[model samples]
Target: MSEDYQLVGSGLTVCEHDAPVEGPVVWLDSPSAVLEFVAAGDVSEKIVLARGGTTTFLTPALTAGVKGVMTLQGAPESHLGILSREYGIPCLMSVAFERGVKSSRGETIPPDGAILRLDVSTHPEGRVFIANGNGHLDVAEPAEVDAEAAAQAEQLRALMASYRGELPKGSAGDRQIRARLRTGVVSTSDENVRRDLAGGEVSDYLSYAGWNLWDLIAARQTEGESGLIPRQEYETVAFVQQWSTYARWYARIVEAIGVDGVIELGSLPRREIGTKVNHVHVWATLCPLFGRAIATELGLEDASARPEDLDALIQFGRRLQHGLWGGGPGFVASRGYAAPVLEASWLERFRDEERRLDDPDELSAFRRFNATTELCGFLLHYDCRAGLCDTGPYPLPDGGFLLVRDHFLHEPGYEWASVIDDLPHCVTEAMFFRPDEDVSIAINDIATTFAQPANYLKHLSGAVVYARDRWDTPVSEVRRLDEAEMARIAHRCDEAMLGLYQRIGDQSVDERIADGVKVYTRDMMMPYARAAGVWDEMVAAGFDELSDLARDAYPALTGGAAQQVLGAVFLMGQGLVPAEGLPPAPEVGPEALPVLHEIAIKGSCPDVDGDAEALEAAGLVVATAAGLMLTEAGHARHDELLAAQRESVDLGRLAAAYERFLAVNGPMKSLSARAGSAGEDERFDLVGQAAELVERVEPALRRTADVLPRFAGYLPRLQEAIRRVEEDDWSYLTSPSVDSVHTVWMECHEDYLQTLGRSREAEGSY
Candidate 1:
């Protein structure tokens, strides 16, 4: 058995003590794989292998269900590694394969289902071993179940089993109806779709139900009539459904910001504001409204605060309502949740027109992400349930219910008119509260009305199809679980989602909710900061800097400060609100060119002698109190010089040098960004990162210097900056106004790109 095993790969261990874990390997290389994972049952014993280092690939529920993780690239500081640590899972990254086999998806890995062992008893280095002939690892252990949580698990299972309601007829037949309905909404005329949808009977019933529930809540009523759910129970279910929706909204927003914001850079950090601000619009307005209502209803203290302290929080509502919306109805189409339900063709035509007008490339910085038009927030429920999709069961006026088995049919709370899938966990967590406790029991206690058949097959089906249609999933490769199997997996997935909710002790539930708000802020904003390349500064300021900003402004949604809102409007009117746009380049005399370039790259320079006077005469450099600085004109002139330099340099040699520079730049950028926030251990690691980066970047610097000798100045400048950084003057690492390591590094990068005739916007590597 021992002879049957062979070492296949090795990587840096994320958490050394958590190594030596063994499980069958399963690769998640595509969206289809993720959907398949959602459909599969008993994945608790499977070790997941992926290529990217981002946590967005796996949903939090899916991550909780897996055994361990391994990646082809990324370090312990990567997002996936951070999540693994939070979950107490073993992770290894940046694996170097000794021998490799390619899978159908074009990823190289151990054969799927092969038992593998990850041993990292050696601390930093971890090894991967695959079973050869025996196909087994002797030390593999079954996952242990916690005794304390088992009782709650049993209660949940029992509750699910108690459902006595009628299920949708014929699983395959139901799926076809749903597929057609979804297709109709996206492609056909809305009139025909609406006619097929029983002339808005579904929406009518949903509205009537919602109104009845609202009225009951207003009356403080809890009793129910025969064959109907109690008003109080409905309220609890509604709260859980809404709570889960908010949580999922937060997660999805983070995913969009973290993943989409950096797509142009391929895992490198860059500041992309379009996605961030767009999401902030929803968070600041509609999300806070719901949060405030929830807090008030629960008698919990409102977490609202003033928003002016956070740079990102200012003027989001004004931007969303006026600036983005001014582009047209299409720009705000996703948020038009209350608009009367239109026919499918009308919606499609509207979408087409919007696409034509909002040429994403030509849009202003605030409108750059015109592609993020997917309906989100409470809008999703309204559009799917009350609008064209009409995912609700209705009385046909003749006989049996017209159960439109569309995208949300099997979702637990959808028939009750909800869209979020994390409701099981939400309900389980909320069960610790009063009305919620009664609501949880009332939901399944009757079996046939609310959240009955508590399965998510249709929800998963719609999600897979959504991915296929919107995200370009390969249609032929898609897979679906059968009804029974889906039901089983749904139960398990819900249990997995309930992990955090299950660990409650005697602590106050209100405090738990508050703590949840804090966690949500840190988790959501950290990724945004990282994607924006401000994680280090934010962390160094005390993660509290970002956290407090999030805590202060987020729950309040602009913090409810009148002055902040008014100031944003004023800034917008003056064309100063979105302040990062670039100005046109300026032309200058050859004599003034280098001086302007020096000031531009170094942030400022000593006026010394008559250089500043000459540049000032040329309307370029300005003599500031600090020193010689580039005016707007000077900066533009420097840009002109940057563009013209390509004609005088060896382009081929410069490109090659830049490629080498990139190999080291990512680690260097990450280290410099983290300098302010590193702990003692992390400080030591950063030192190693700095040394390693210096050694690796040397050849690239030397090659570039061969092409442009002026570039020779960068190496020693970087060395001096690093030397200063070592002496505890940390500002030498990234401060822009000096020959700091990052400053000199970016100067070299800018010069290299300019000499190669490349645009930073086009390359998106900044």
Candidate 2:
């Protein structure tokens, strides 16, 4: 039997031991195959070797009766390896398995029902032997196996003993933090909360859900035992030290700045605003520690900090830290919860595909683009430092970035290469800045140009009114606000809004445009840009477009009409009654009269044919302005128009159109992927297909815009991307740098979820 066997494949061991296990070889090709084999009771006492890389669906089989797992593809940090380590399952990845092999004597080797022996103790390379007989004697003795397990258990005991005694030392605040961790509030059950902790050994609590510190240490000692390398072990140690140091700094800053001061600094009413500002405060406090982390990661030495450049260093460092921790799995998971309708709908499709074995394309595609995967990929590409800041330095569960360029290189379609290349590079360079740059002065200058009182007022009033209107029950119950008090708050918001318009006249269109770009880019869009790896380029392009539009459309916005229209549009989008209210007459001077008339005729403004006093008496008009102000009657008319427009929208039709759009859009991957190293003609052909799909969905999107005008911007943006694609500017095809096709599609989907008042978690299939 031994003579009949032949050599097959070799790979690195995931769980190291001197013992060997022999079992019948079971070859599985896909997730469904694994499931089928388990259901059929064929997995018992078998060595399961599967094709393809790590997938979430394979988890069930891995946990079943299989003796071990050998995969054609998987990395040390891949989901398979992670699970294997967690479950104490012996595994090998990147295995080369031979089928229908013949021996040197031209005899069939290891025929059907072959017994496979997997010996993993050999360092660097493991061995796989196959024998023709069902029983092979290469398996380790039972006593030896038991002894090896006992040794591992003893090692773990010693490691845990050491870890438990090493209490963190720090100031009072730091002690308080450590006390909280010891009290169990920061344990595995509270992984969500612990994930948000800025810096601390508290992060280790994530591993408590599965493996412990003992496992980590033992794995490190055994080298390849835990599917991690020596460098990874060193980094893990560094991470713990860095986190503790930063935690101390964070504690000191909180003590110095006071919790109230930090809260006050993040005055915005939004929950995310408070959270992000708190993160910023932490970064600011621990600037030096973060600088060192950046320097260490970038292979830089400790340099002298110039007083003049300190602020810039701090700002750049803050941005870097934010990029690292912000917009990670926790953030994206929160988005999933908030937008449950979208999440549920997308996931339903994914599940449907998962159920079908005959067609795995959709399942594979969905897995690649699912929200969690996308978020992880985003972190890898943008937040983690790897591959020109375009490719993902895939994040590990332990707050470390895993360099996984080789994994992408071997990915099935090679589309990820194009995806990586398309990402912007320079934006992440902020994290690696030298000590002398005057980044602070530039940041301050930009902030000054962008700070507009009107924009702030707009956001504040919008938030206040939106809360009061949409959350009336909760607000009234919580605040015990009577109608009179609620009315007072509303009036105050209106007054503030009125003040904003009055100040709008102080700045010219050019100035407003510049300031708007700064505010929108830095304050509103920067977070998204950082996560998407398109910060500088996207902001510049978006602002450039805004500037061009303002210049070209100057005539239509004269005589303070721009501000009025803007306020109207803003309020309407928020689902709040326009404060300026629609007016019936010429509120503009002679030069702008034609523009105002044109607007009214276009049904963009209300037309007043009756007496103003009668309209007010009827409660149709409350107060008249030099500009449009809607009385009760005018407000009703406006609502009627909106209602009519909304009535035109068929949700079912729109949903189907969207589904069709995704079906066509999903396969295109990226512009370069479609081009496929082919000639320009092939690229143009692919572009035409995408453009045609865009055209197909235009009518549905237009109808959607009628109901929710916020969606109106998406159609134009999609058209622009298509136009750019047609002009051979392929970057716009799927580029996140600007209003690319994919970006606009995603925004449109978000609008649909919002307008329909649907949660991503609960929504039905599209």
Best by lDDT: 1
> How well is each residue in 653-755 modelled by candidate 1, as lDDT tens digits?
8888889999988888787778878776776567657867887899999998999887887888888888887887767877887668888888888777666
Model 1 global lDDT (CA atoms, 0 to 1)? 0.42
lDDT of 2 by residue, 335-439 (tens): 211111111232232223222213344332222222122222222221111111111222223332211010111111112223333221211100011112211
lDDT of 1 at 222: 15
- Cα lDDT of all candidates, in order? 0.42, 0.36
**How many residue pairs clash per model?**
5, 24
TM-score of each: 0.26, 0.24
Best by TM-score: 1
Off by over 4 Å in 2: 1-78, 81-157, 160-162, 166-177, 180-766
